[model samples]
Target: MRQLIVTEFMSLDGVIDSPGGGDHPHAGWTFKDIEMDEAAYEIKGREQEEAGALLIGRVSYDEFAPVWPKMEEFAEYNAMPKYVVSTTLTDPQWHNTTVLRSLDEVAALKRGDGAPLLVHGSANLAQNLAAAGLVDRYHLLIFPILLGGGKRLFAPQDAEKQKLKLVEHATYGNGVQMAVYDVVR
Candidate 1:
């Protein structure tokens, strides 16, 4: 079975909102504010290679479609398959991209034998996948600060529960903590 890994750059308090700038009120708190070393980049590169495909929420898709594809350095990701979960997007401009309207479609994709399908920067989609019990693993890169108020990975929905077992962890030179866990049922 193909694993579905939800990866995100979050704050200490679990805020995964827009970290770029202006797009989210709690923006610019992730890694942009500080300097990172070569180790973090190398680690991230490894994570990118472990996934066969990318799964992104509509918002993240929109944010990335115009940027990552144009960057020459991210050639591998630009060429890799991308699946965007969106309700209204009819046409996806990114090469090797497809739009999925429902969460059930993700389950079918995971049934195939392949490298893990990675979901990045999609808090809402991650929560839905969590609620549906579809996410197999979670790889979070948690930064040091807490953004008091911002988007959260887990939503407030009448006490939902998830059983997660820590599989691996590492601390980068930039004070970024990486945690990988498998979801247990």
Candidate 2:
């Protein structure tokens, strides 16, 4: 079975929304604070290379589709197979894109054998996947700053006790912490 890896750029206060210039007031906070070094770029490149597919939400897909395709850095992301979970998203203009309408479909996709399905910046989808015990691993790049009011990675309503085993951790020169956790089932 393919592992569902939830990768997020989050704040110290657990806020995951608008890390890179969005509608949120704390937009571009990650860019403003954390200095991306060669190591960071290498890490991102490694993750992209390892991921066979991307499972993202409609909002994330809409936010990324136009931009990632234009950038040379995200060429791998643009070329990889993508599954966007949205009932309302009809036409996916990006190449190798498919629209998934239900959670059952998502679960089925998880059962298939492949490289890790990397999920990026899809807070709603991530929450659902976590709640369903579908997320196999979490790769969080935590910035030092705290954004008190914003969409969080884990909300209050998500009260289920899901145990996690710390697999790896590292800190960059800019004080950004990279933590990898395995969801203990």
Judging by lDDT against the true structure, name the best candidate.
2
Worst 10 residues of 1 by lDDT: 34-43
| TM-score for candidate 1 | 0.93
Segments of candidate 1 deviating more than 4 angstroms: none
Tens-place lDDT per residue, model 1, 14-131, is 8889876537765777657756766655656876777799999998988888889878877877888899999999999999999988988888888889998999888889988888
* Per-candidate total of colliding backbone pairs: 0, 1
lDDT of 2 by residue, 1-185 (tens): 99999999899999999999889897999887677656654557888999999999999999999898999988888889999999999999999999999878989998999899999999989999888888999999888898898888798574598899999888888888889999998
Q: Which candidate tops TM-score?
A: 2
Model 2 earns a TM-score of 0.96
Give the whole-model CA lDDT for all candidates, comma-separated. 0.83, 0.89
